[model samples]
Target: MSRSLQTLRRLALPAALAAALLAGLQAARATEAPVSLAAVALGEADYQRVNDALVQHHVVPRYQVMAAAMAALDAAAGRYCAAPGAGTLAALRAADEAAVDAWMGVQHLHFGPVELFMRSYRLYFWPQGRGRIAQATGELLAAADPASLEEQHFRNASTAIQGLPALEVLLYGEGAEETPSAFRCALLTRIACNMKAMAADIVEEWQGGKIDFARTVAEPGPDNPYFESAEEATLAFFQSLYNGLELISDARLKPVAGASIEKAKPALAESRAPGRSLRNVVVNLEALQGLYEGEGGPGLGDLAVRSGADPKLEPLLRKAFRLTVETAKGIEPPLAEAVVDPKRRKAVDKLLTQLVAIKQILRSRFSPATGLPIGFNAMDGD
Candidate 1:
C-alpha cells in the first residue's frame, strides 16, 4: 500500500485499539523524515506546474514591468526634450531611475526571449569601461540628429550608447544638474525610445509573440527544441538563481571591490557615476526571492523539497537567501566610493562573504536536491 494510504489506515483504526500499539506506531513513524505526500511521485504534473508557475508568475511579469517602465522613460525623455527645465529634467531623471530599477529586477534572466537579438545587452550593456558610455553618448550628440539613434539606424550602433548606461552618462555627471542642449536631449530621447522598443520586444516574445520562448520553456517534450523534459526546464530555472548570484559575486562585485583592502579598485565599480550600483544588486536579490518562493503559487523550493525529502532543504534555502538579501540591504550606496572607504568597505566585503556562504548551500544541497550540478552555469563556455 502507498505510505500515505498506510498512514491513513493506521489513523482510521477504532479508538478502542490498544494504547501500546498506538504508541509503538507513533514512535516508529517519528524516526522517518517527513515527506510531502503530493511530492512523493515526483512526476510530470509537478514539474509542469512549477514550470508554468515560474514563467507566468515570476519571469513574464518582471519583463512586463521593465517594458512599462521603459515606455514611461521614453515619454519622459520626449517631454523633457520638448521643453528643457528643472521640472522636466527632474521628471526625466525619475523615469530613468524607474526604468533602471525595473530592469534590474529582470536583468538576471538572460535566456529565453531576452537572449533573442541580444536584447538584454541592448537594454543595459554593462562594464562599458567607465568613460565609454560618455564617449558613445557624446558621439550620438555630436551627430546632432535623432536619426542616428532611431531604431533602424541605431540597431547596429555601438552597444554602449544603445541602452541605460548611455542614459546615465547623459543624465548623472557634472553637467547633469542642468538641462542639456536641445541636440543632446534629442539623442537622449532617441536612445530612450530605442530601449523602450527593446523592452517591449522582450515582453511580447515571452508572452507569445513570434519567438514564444515562454511556450518552449513551459511545454518541454522530446520534440521540443529548448527542453526535452521538465527536469531540464527545472535546471534552467535553477541556473538563473545560480548564475545571478555568481554574476553579482564575480562579475559585479569582486572586479570592483577587489580581493583585499590594498587591492580595491573603486573606479571599476559599475553604475558608479549614477550612484545606484548597490541598489541594482539589492533589487536583483528581491527578484531572486520571488523566484524561490514563487510569486503566487508553488516555486522551486517546493520542487526541491519534493525531490529528495531533504528535511533541511527548504529552511536552509530560506535562511541563505534571506541573509544574503539582508546583507546586501545593509550596505550603503555610491558603491564606487564605498568600496574604497576604509570604514564603509567592510559592509561591501561582508556582502561578498554572505554571497559565498549562500552559493555553497546552493552547490552542496539545493542544486543536488533539484538534480542540477554545482558550477553548471554556461559562463565557462561549456
Candidate 2:
C-alpha cells in the first residue's frame, strides 16, 4: 500500500475504536433508570415544619444580619465621607468587608422578596460586564452633585453603580483611598445608603404583614398566589438548594478554575477586588449545609428521614458538605491568585470535585429520598 493510504488506515482504526467506545457509554447512560423520590410522602404538617424551620433558622436570620451589616456600612461611609481621614477610610473598608461577608452568607437564598425588585442584582452585579461598573461609577463620581446624592437618585442610577461591586471599585480602585475626591466620597455614601435601603426592603417584605412570603410557604392555600400547595413550596425550597449548588459549581468555581490550568480564568472569581473569593465560597457552602441540615430544625434531611429516605444518605451528604467547606477554607485568600498557582489550583480543583460529588448525591439520592421530581430544572432560565 502507498504510504499515505497506510497512514489513513492507522488513523481510521483508532478513530473507529473511539467512536465505538463513545457509543457504548451513551448506551449505558440511556439504559439507566430515572431517579424517583415518590416513595417519600409528606403531609401538610410536615410541610409546615420544614417551611417554618427554613424561615426561622435560615431566611429571616440571614436577611436580618445582612440588613444590619449594610446599615453599619452606610454609617461608616457617611463618617468617612464627612471626615476623609485615614482612620475613617479604614473603618469604611472594614464595614464594606463585613457587609460583603454578610451578603455572601445569604446570597444563596435566591427567591421570594429579593427577586421582586431586582434587589439581588442591585445588591451585587457580578461578572463585571467588562468594566461597566467602573465606567458607570466613574461617571457618577465625576458628574453627580454632592447634594444630589440622595436615595431617589441612586434608585434611578445605573444598576451597575448601585451595589457592592461598584462600591468596591470606588473604595479600592486607583487613587480611591489616598485622594478620594469630594464627589467620590459622596458617591460612596450614596451607594452604601442604597445598599442598606435594599437590604431593609428585603427584610421588610419577608416580615411584612401585608405579604409575608414565609407565611405563604408555611400555610399554603388557594388564596395564596405564590404557592398553591405545601408540596410546591417544598419543591421551591429544594430548587433553591439545588440551584445554590449549581451556582457554586458552575458559575463561581468553574469559571475561575477552568477545565485545566492552561485555560484557567482567575480574574473571573467573584468579589476579586476585595480578595474574598474563597471566603465567599466557604460562606456559600455553610449556607447550603444549613439548608440541608435545617441548622437544628426540620430541614430536607429531616423530611427525608421522616418520609423513609435512606438513613445513611443524610449523614453521608453532611460529611461531604463538611469536607468541602474544610477544603475551601484551606485555600488562600484572593482566589484570583490561587487560581493561577499550581499548588493552590490543585486544591481548588479538589474542592470542585467534592462539590460535584455533593451535587450528584443531591441529584441521585437526596432528591429521590424527598420525592423531588427527577429532571426538574432547579435553576433559573431553565
Candidate 3:
C-alpha cells in the first residue's frame, strides 16, 4: 500500500465514538445543579489590568515562541532538502515536534489576527476530513514539479496539503526517511517556509502596533469592532478557556477512548503519526493552567480572589490542574499505543475522568467565583 494510504488506514476509526460519548456526557450533566454568577461588578481598571497581564505574559510570549519554533523548522527543512541524510531527517523531525509544541501553546487563542486570512487552517489542517491529507499528499508527490513548488505556488495550494499534517506524512510516514525524492524535499521546504512566514506575521500583528490588539481589547468601546465592553472582552477570553478544554476532551480524547473500554480505538488520537498526541494534551493543560493562575501576573484566578470569592478556590483549581497534567504524563508515551494496552487503557480512562473534573470546576466553581457566566456555546457539541 502507498505510504499515505497506510497512514490514513492507521489513523481512521469510527466517527460515532465522539458522538456517543458527548451524548452520554451531556445527558448525565443535564441533571447537575445549575451554576449562576453573582452580580459582582468589575470596573474598567480591573479589565485593563487583566488585559495587560494577558497580553504581556500570555498572548505575546506564546506567539513569539511559535514564530521562533516555526523559523527553526523552516531552516531545518531547508538544510535537510539541501543534504538528504538520516541525520538531517532526524533534525527535521525534531524541529517539526518543537513547532507543534509551540503551536499548542497558543492554539486556543481563536480570535484576533490568528483568525484572519484562514491563517490558522493554513498552519495546521487537522482531522484531515477523512483521508484528504493522504490523498492530497499523494497527488502532490506524484505530480509535483520542483520548479513550481515555490512560495507563491503554496499560497494557492489546497489547504489540506499546506499545513503540519502534510508535513508529518512526508517526514515520518513509511520509508520517507529512507528515500527522499528531490520533489518531496522541495515541497517540504516550501511548506515549512510558508508556515514560518505565517507565524511571524501573527506575532507582528499582535505586537508591532499594526493592530493595537491590547488597546482594542482593554479599552473596548462602540468604536472597537471586536469588543464593546470590558465584560464582553472578559467573556471572550473565558470562552477561549472553555473551548480549549472542550477541544481536548471531545475532539482529542473522546474518539480514541470511546464510550467504553471494550470499544477504545487508540489509532484515532491526534498527532498520533508522530507519537506526540499525549504531549499535546499536556502542553494544552499547561497553557490553560497558566491562563487561570496568571503565571506570575494578573489572571482570572486573581480576579476571582479580589472579588471577595473564596481564596481557596484558586488553590483547589490549581491542584486539579496539577493532577490532570501528572496523570497524563503517567499514561505511556505515544497515546495510540497506550490506549490499547490493558494497564495503559485504565490510565487513559483515568485521564479522561480527571479532565471531566477540571471542566466541572471551571464551570461550577471558576465561572461563579469570577462572576463570569459559563459560555454554553463553548460546551455544546453537535
Candidate 4:
C-alpha cells in the first residue's frame, strides 16, 4: 500500500473509536433524568439534546481532531529524527502548518453547533459550560512548553473552545435583538450574565481542586468559591424561575412566587454558599407544594381538607425527594449507610411507595377534568 493509504488506515481506527466513545457518553446523558428542586424546572429532554449536540459535534470531534493532528506531527517527527540533516526548518514549519490546518478544520465543523448548545445551557445550567471553559483555559495557561508543536496544537484547541461563548452571544444575541420580547431579552441577558458567572465559578472550582492550576487560582474565603463568584449565574437561574412563575396564573403561584422571590432576593443581592442557596431552593419547592395543595384545586383538598393527606403534588415532590436521597446514596458507603441506616432506607422506600399511590389518586381524581396527565398543568390556574 502507498504510505498515504497506510496513514489513512491508521487514522481511521482512532477516529472511529473517538466517535463511538462520544456517542456512548451522549447516550448515557440522554437516558439519565435531571435533578431539580422545582416542579417547573427545565425539561430533561432539552438538557439531553444540548448535551448530545455538544458531545457529538464539538466534544467528540475534538478527540478525532487531536488524534489526527498528533499522528501527523509524529509522522513528520519520525522523518526529521531519522534524517536530521535532511529536514530543514522550512520543512518542519510546513508540516506544522499542515497539522494545525487539519486540526482547525475539525474545530470549524464543531464550533458553531457546540456554541449553540452552550447558549441553550446558559438559559438553564449556565455554570456548567462556563466551568468547562474555565478548566480548559487554565490547563492551556499552565502548560510548560507553550511554544512547542504539541503545546501549539493544544493552544489552538483551547483558544477555539474559549471563543465559543462569545461567538454564541454574537450569533444568538443579534437575532434576539431584532425581536426583543420580554422572553428574548430575558433569555439574552441571562445568557450574558451566565457566561461571566459560569467562568467565575469555573475558576473557583479549579482553584478548589488539588490540581496545581487550581491552587494557583485559590481564594481565601468560602467553601465553594464558584458560588461566591457565581452571582450572575445564580440570578439567571432565578430569572428563569421567575419566567416559569409568569407562565402559571394559579393562586398557588402567589406563595410559590413569594417564596421563590424571597430566596432569589438573597442570592441576587449577595454571594451565599451554594449549599445554603440550594437548601433555600428546596424549601421554596416544598413551600410551593403546600400552597398548591391549599388552593382548592384538586385531591381531597389539601391533605388537611380530608381525613387523609392529598396526593396531587406528592408525585412531583416524591421525584425531587428521591433525587436527593439517591444523590446521597453516592456518598462513601460507610458515611451513607451510617447516615441512612437500614431503617431510614426502609422509610424512604415506604414513602416512595406512598408517592406512587398518590399518583394513582391524582390520576383518577383529576385526569378527567384536565384531559392531560395527572400532574400536567394541575397547579391552580395552570
Candidate lDDT scores, in order, read 0.77, 0.77, 0.77, 0.31
Residue range 1-382, candidate 4, lDDT tens digits = 8533332233224335334434533453354313111222323333233223333333334434444544454455444434443343235334444433333323222122223434223312222433454354334334533332232242233332333332233222333124233332222223233333433333333334443222321221255432232222222222222222222211112222222222312222100211122222323333223222322333112222221122233443334334433333332322223223444334323322332333333344222222223334533465
lDDT per residue as tens, model 3, 8-83: 2322222432344345335534543242123245566676688778878989899999999999999999898888
Off by over 4 Å in 4: 1-120, 123-281, 287-291, 294-340, 374-382
TM-score of 4: 0.23
Colliding residue pairs in candidate 3: none
Give the TM-scores of the predictions, in the order they appear: 0.85, 0.87, 0.86, 0.23
Model 4, C-alpha of 104: deviation from truth (Å): 40
Clash counts for the predictions, in order: 0, 1, 0, 1
lDDT of 2 by residue, 318-371 (tens): 667777788889888778888889988877877777776667667766666676
**What residue pairs are clashing in model 1?**
none
**Against the true structure, what is every candidate's RMSD?**
10.3, 8.9, 9.2, 25.9
Question: What is candidate 2's CA lDDT for residue 42?
Answer: 66
Candidates in descending TM-score order: 2, 3, 1, 4
Residues 56-166 of candidate 1: C-alpha lDDT, one tens digit per residue: 999888889988999999999999888888899889989999999998899778788778777788888876565877887776677777567566888878888788988
